[model samples]
Target: MMFRRTAFTVGLLALASSMYSHAEKVEWSQGSGQSDGIVVSDGANNNARTAYLSISSAISVPAIKKTQEEVSTLKRELAEVQRNAEEMKRQLSTQQNQAASGLKDSSANLSKEIDDLKRENQSLKSALDDVKRQQSQTASSGSSNSSNVSREMDGLKRSVEELSRENDKLSSSNDRLSQRLNDMDRSLSSLESKVK
Candidate 1:
C-alpha cells in the first residue's frame, strides 16, 4: 500500500509539472481601449484554466499621477513656508539687535548727562557755600553787599531746581525705555515658541 501511495504521488507531481510547462502568459487586449491585461493560459486547452489579471484595473494610473502631483505641490508649499519663516526670524533678530543697540546708546548718553549734571550741581553748591562764607565775613561792612550775596544765592537755588527737574525727566525716559525692552523680549520669546 505504501509503494502504491508513492507511485500515485509521483504521478500527480509529474502531471502538475507538465501542466506548469504548458502554461503560457499572453497579453489580453480589452474592448474598452483600457490597458492590456495578463492572461495565464494552459496550452493544452484554449478555454480551460485561464486567469485574467488586469493590473491597470486594480491600480488606476490617473489616480496615482494625481496623488504624486498633490504630494509634489504640498512639498513645494512646505518648503516655501519654511523659507518665509526663516526670513521672518532673520528680520526679527536684526530688529532686536538694532533696538538693543539703540537702547544701550541712549542709556549711555542719559547716564553721562546725569553724571555731568550732578557734578555741575555739586560745583554750584560749593560756590554758593563760598559766597555765603564771604557774605558772613563782610556782613559787618554794608547792607548793599549782603543783598548782592542773597541774590547770588537765589540764582544758584534756581539753577539747582532746574537741574533736578531735568534729571527727573531723564530718569523717566530711561524707565520707559527699559519697559519697552522688557515688552520686546516677551514678544520675541512668544514668537520663538510659536515657531518651534
Candidate 2:
C-alpha cells in the first residue's frame, strides 16, 4: 500500500510541473546573428521585472516634475534677490553723492571763513599799529607840555617873591610917613605957645 501511495504522489507532481512549464511561452526570432524573444506567462504569475519598471517610472515622472517646479521657484527667488541688491546699490550711490556734496559745501564754507578771519586779523594788526603810533606821538607831546608847565611854575614863583619884596617896601614907607606927621604936630604946638 505504501508503494502505491508513493507512485501516485510522484505522478501528481510530474503533471503539475508539466502544466507549469506549458503555461510559460517563449518565442524567438533571429535577425542576422542576434536573437530577440517574447516571453509570455500565465496571468496568475506576476512578473517582478515588468512591475518594477512600471512602478519606478510612475514614481519618477511625478518626482521629476516636482523637481522642475522647485527649480523654477528657486530661480525666481534668486532673481528677486538680485534685483533688491541692485536697488540697494543704487540707493547707496545716491547717498554717497549727497554726502560728497554736503562735504564740498562745508569745505567751501570753511575756506571762506578762513579768508574772512585772515582779513579781520590783518585789519586788527593795522589798527594796533595806528594805536602804537598815536601813543608815541602823545608821549612826545606830553613831554613838551610837561616842560611848559615847569617853566610856568618857575615864573609864578619868581613873581610871588617880587611881590613879597614890594609889600615890605610899602610897609616901611607907611611907617616913615606916620613919624613925619607926628613931628609936624609937635612943632606946630610949640609955635602956638610962643605966640601966646
Candidate 3:
C-alpha cells in the first residue's frame, strides 16, 4: 500500500516535470511567446503544478522516512521479543532439568531405602531361623543342665519376637514409602503436563 502511494506521488512529480519542461521549450521556440503570449499562461500553469507536486512530494518524503523508521523499529521490537522468548525457554528448560534431577535423586534415595529394608528383612529372617534351630536343639537334648539353657532360650525367644515386630513395622513403613514415591511420580507427571 505504501509502495503504491509513493509510486503515484513519483508519477505525478514526473508528469509535472515533463509539463514544466514542455512549457519551457514552447517559450523558447516562440521568442515573443516567452513572456507575453498564450505560452505564458501555459508556463504559469506548469510552474504552479510543479510547485504543488514538489510540496506534495516533499510531504511524502517525511512520511516515507517515518514509515521506514517505524518498520525498522517494529523489526527491532520483534527481535527483542524473540530474544526474550528464547531466554524464557532456556530458563524453563533449566528449571525442568533441575526438577528431573531432584526426582531422580529422590528415586535413588527411595531405592536405597528399599534395599536397606530388604537387607534388614533378610537379617531378621536369618536370626529367626537361628533361634528356631537353637530351640530344636535344646528340645531334643535331655541334658542335666537344661534349666539354665531353657532360661537363656526364653531370652532368645523374646529377642526373636521383638525382631519380628520390628520386621512387621519395617514392612509397613516400606509399603508407605513405596506409595509415597508413586505419588511423587504422579505429581511430577502432572507438573510436566502443566508446564507444557
Candidate 4:
C-alpha cells in the first residue's frame, strides 16, 4: 500500500510539472480573476485529486501598456519618416524637370544663334567674292578704278576679320556652355545617387 501511494505521488508530481510548463505558454488573461483547476486520478485506488493553478500573478498590465505605447510611438515615427521621404522625392523631381527645361532652352537658343552667325558669314563671303571679281575685271582700266577697288577690298577684308573674331567668340561661348551643362548633369547624378 505504501509503495502504491509513493508511485501515485510521483505520477501526480510529473503531471503537475507538465501542466505548469504548458500553462507558462498560455496567453495571460486581461483580468486577474480565477484560479484554474485540473483533476488527476490514481488508477489503483480509483481516487481523484484536484490541483488549482493561479496565473493572475504572472500577468503584468503596466508592462503590457508600456509596450503597446512604445509600439504606437514607433509607428508614428515611421509614418513621419515615410512622409518626409516622399516630400524629398517630389522636390527632387521638380528640380530635375526645371533644370532639364532650362538646359533645353539654352541649347536651342545657342543653336539658333550659331545658325544665324553661319548664314551671316556665308553672306559676307559671297559679297567679298563679288567685290574681288569686280576688282580683277577693272584692274587694267585705270588707277582711279584700281584705287576704288582696293578700298572696297580693304573694307571687305576688315568685315571678314570681324566675322572671324565673332565666330571665335561664339565657339568659346559654346564650349563654356557645354562645360556648364556637363557640370549640371554630374551634380544631378550625384543628387540622385545620394537619394537612392
Candidate number of the best TM-score: 3
Error of 4 at 94 (Å): 0.7
Per-residue lDDT tens digits of candidate 2, residues 70-178?
A: 9999999999999999999888767656655554555455455545545554555555455555545555565657776566556555654554555455445545544
Model 3 lDDT per residue over 16-116, tens place: 55756655333212224232112222553454221332223334567789999999999999999999999999998889877877877897798789889
Task: State every prediction's TM-score relative to the real structure.
Answer: 0.54, 0.47, 0.63, 0.53
* Over 4 Å off, model 4: 1-57, 142-196
Question: Ten-residue segment with the worst summed lDDT in candidate 2?
Answer: 48-57
Q: What digit string (tens of lDDT, one per residue) describes model 4 on residues 50-75? A: 46444334455788899999999999
Q: Model 3: runs farther than 4 Å from truth?
A: 1-59, 142-150, 184-196
lDDT of 3 at 71: 100
RMSD value for candidate 1: 10.0
Candidate 4: lDDT over CA atoms? Answer: 0.62
Quickly count the clashes in candidate 3.
0
Pick by TM-score: 3 or 4, better one: 3
